[model samples]
Target: MFKKLSVLAITFVLLLGCLPMLSAQAAGNATAKQPGNSNPLMDHKLGADPFALTYNGRVYIYMSSDAYVYNSNGTVKDNDFSALNKINVISSADMVNWTDHGAIPVAGANNVNGSAGIAKWASLSWAPSAAVKKINGQDKFFLYFANGASGIGVLTANSPIGPWSDPLGKALVTGSTPGMSGVTWLFDPAVLVDDDGSGYLYAGGGIPNTSDPASIASPKTARVLRLGADMTSIVGSASTIDAPYMFEDSGIHKYGGKYYYSYCFNFSGTHPAAYPAGEIGYMVSNSPMGPFTYTGHFLKNPYTFFGVGGNNHHAVFNFNNQWYVVYHAQTVAKAVLGDGKGYRSPHINKLVHNSNGTIQEVQGDMAGIAQIANLNPYTRVEAETIGWNAGITTERTQAAGGPVSNMNVTNINNGDWVAVGNADFGSSGASSFKANVASATGGGKIEIRLDSATGPLVGTLNVPNTGGAQSWQEVQTTVSNAAGVHRLYLVFTGSGSGNLFNFDYWQFSTGGDGGTTPPPVSKVEAEDMTLSGTYAGKITSPFSGVALYGNDDAAAFNQYYAYGTHNFSVRGASNNSSTARVDLLIGGVNVGSFNFSGTTPSVQTLTNVAHATGNQEVKLVVTTDNGSWDAYVDYIEWSQ
Candidate 1:
């Protein structure tokens, strides 16, 4: 009996020892986000009502900012959308790694630009839509948003990630607008710029007010209107789009010369076999101002895929010759809070358009679409571009003399790291790495790793105090054994610290050869190079020894070794009253151009110019003639 009791006691102790392991297994099962999953785009913040814009080989997603709301007891409350006065923006070139461009303070009492909002007249902003049109040979971006359920407002900017401003200082659409008398909710705008450059705006949703069942079945509340040439103004009165079971969330896309109008199906009444409640349904029309025919639904409700039900919102776009749809789900919130609480995060999946003009039904899941392209690590990559990360946040700040407001990775502590997916270091491998960084306190070390955060260590860059957090400087470190395509991880480490450093952008060098030695930082004097054309001449300058000056002249530097992408800086000046242009060519291929106006000789640097390997002929050609006055060149520097 004593032996049996001892055996039982031992078994009990062993079972007690296994409790934490079983509990950990249960916690791991509850984690909605998994390693290598591309869904939700980012885990640092929550965003909803995703709209995508493709420009210059990148896809930019604009979303309504969804933040946590807390109860009086310090627990998370259901999302009320009261703090949704800002719109978040993120972009990706390869789809797997997304760069957080920060948020646009659209409407609020205080904002990034100033105390007043970008659109100060509007109290709330939600469900944003973005469109870019070339006006007067320059691209102009327009952002449209819902001002609660009452009206719609528009903001304009010079770039997609904007420091935007209200053009009219008022709402664009309201109850009094012509032909909008029946719209139950005048919001959720979607804009499309057709192939012919004509722009159309699709807005409005909600069931009709009549008690007739037909009204609920076919609520003719959605509206489409012609946008003016400027895209900021309405060209004509809105027209009705009689969509069946219309709830909200209007989406528009053109495929195979046919217009598709998609919206959420209303859940108020019994949905027909053809229409399911909370799913995304669509209609087809030949014209933008549509007398449409109801088509089939392409996307089901979130509950159908994620096991969590909520309102449906989406945007369909063609990026890199492939169709994709970005939508919002409560997966992240549910994973954290055990219940979603209505907080949302954006997700993306492949969208297919069948050959017959019908869109293939999209199956939304945690596994997203494969990356279409590999990221080039040779060029300057924004530090905020992340595939996965832990213990980090991003903030908006301006890079020194940068044209637009930029975002930097911040709030980094020990063990924090950011990863970039599928970074192609090429066959030559990388010899060195550099980053624009700043630190207010004692700085930390950046551990350059490959594959995973704990993977092979390639190099380490020690960051130093740069006086202030915004006072930036370029720091470099030698890299070795980093080649081919791998997930690049920037792991942070330091002694006693709360925060370490702020990172802006980083680049890798290939030494202009396959060698592991760091590339020489040198300049090729333009005056010493071979010159041609009618006005080619050499002159003496105080800034630089001998300078090359000419109009319609070309200076050639032979046997110049260049690899990957490098910062090309030209020290020159132009006395022309108008802007003078100089073209840079490598191996007869035009890489880029530089424009200068004033006579003051200063350095003009162009970052991230792609170059081919081996020895090549580099040329500086004065393509633009500024009267008899010529553009002067002192020397041309690369990778300095």
Candidate 2:
């Protein structure tokens, strides 16, 4: 539970506006090509219980990160519930471009405050719901969560991303607590604050041991309780509502003058998977505490249609004058490729209500939501603000000796990239790029590419040895054409056979016309091409920027040419320690060792080499001095 701060209790009043009507065909197909965000808006991690809170102008989605017991396979690793102790909070104004706000501090057993450590909830943190209300003229955000059916807890903060504290240094509801003792699953707590400033807490569900037939037929119930004015304690006795077949994941909200109670249920009759991971069912009542009328069904499981599905939890809210439904699915292929188990990711889609005020069923889409506004590159943008990324991960470490843990891109290697999408640079376009970075093994550069990783290079920020990885330094590079709204990929290049560097944040200046996406280039991946001495592990989407890592001098190999002289270029990074020379070999013979710069990757061209066409294995042998030991290679390309 979180401590209270000053938060003005604000009432949610639906704003009037014209919205695009939803076609019925968009309801059942997970591949539905309608206007919506792609599933797994968060591809880097697994999250569940996606709760949407529209505070002020931005919408923050609070969820349970699957790292607690995360496994790439469909099954939770060792079922270690403690791994789910933390909660992730990501926000977006346009509902498409999300900014990760690190994590919400949920303390575990005997954990210290004012720091980001593990062990917040003893059992685990699952199905958390957050709401911001005005308290004494100031706005305060309240986070409601549970430790995997162990008990229910609360945490409060002045802002969504906060210095959180338990209102009560323990769970607010427990199994031994009066009416709660009868129910086994005392988790998935959902809290709703009515416009009248009244707060309601709903929890308790069925035991998930489906193998034991006796457990399946056990009577199920999801109850609601009136929370105290101080919200830290219960105000009255729990009222058991008839949420038929409601297994768990209870969510409540007030919309269109009606109290909408949404939850996960086993309506399919066949217990498909454990706990019958099925569809989202709803029930409506006139009062927040009511005799709810089950409204049949609204949303189906994406796993059934798209081969990627899991237990579903969701939240519905209106943002930017339009209503949306936010839910989690096993959208990443890591799970669906197997038996359809493992972690879940969040997704958003346009939610339109029927003519009679009943919301219609919705499906997942690739387009996501439309951009709310054009991004002004002139302002500072966090490198963590990623629209699409490959071969990279993030971490929270002390920033440049500062106590504040800033989230930055880690695990950087040759070819890794982060793409910030749809940046609108009006007519004045951008002229330069600046970035704050750190690297233990210094020397590497950021190629400012547009649209794709190998797209048109607009600018290059050459990085100098800034002391170490956590050692922060700002580097700026000039650009010619970088204008308008398009995907910008920051591709990392350098020499080291190991990690390249870390990226903090970046910004662009208005000086030149924006560039356009470059046409595709033809080249073979290192994993598919030749192999030789001192090379590192094969690179993959993990660092989407490149495909391979060269360690030192390699054995010879062949690369084919069209029997005539043609120019060719090399793309890759090198060891951060030195500027080594790599000899371009054709038909297992030496051409010359190209003098590559330090760690950062750069393009080097060799003109007029004649060879026969079919496929020829290209070899890159190292020619290094005592100081310069090795070099890295991404791809060997021939000029058009």
Query: Each prediction's Cα lDDT score?
Result: 0.76, 0.62
Pick out the ten consecutive residues of candidate 1 with the lowest summed lDDT. Answer: 14-23
Which candidate number has the best lDDT? Answer: 1
Give the alpha carbon lDDT tens digit for every residue of 129-241 in model 2: 88776554345788888776678888888767776777776778887665665665787788888977789898877644544444543435678888887677887678776
Give stretches of model 1 more than 4 Å off.
1-33, 108-116, 210-212, 401-403, 512-640
| Distance from true location, Cα of 225 in model 2, Å | 1.6
TM-score of 1: 0.77
With candidate 1 superimposed using the best TM-score fit, by how many Å does residue 472's alpha carbon deviate from the native? 2.6
> TM-score, each model?
0.77, 0.69
Error of 1 at 73 (Å): 2.2
TM-score of 2: 0.69
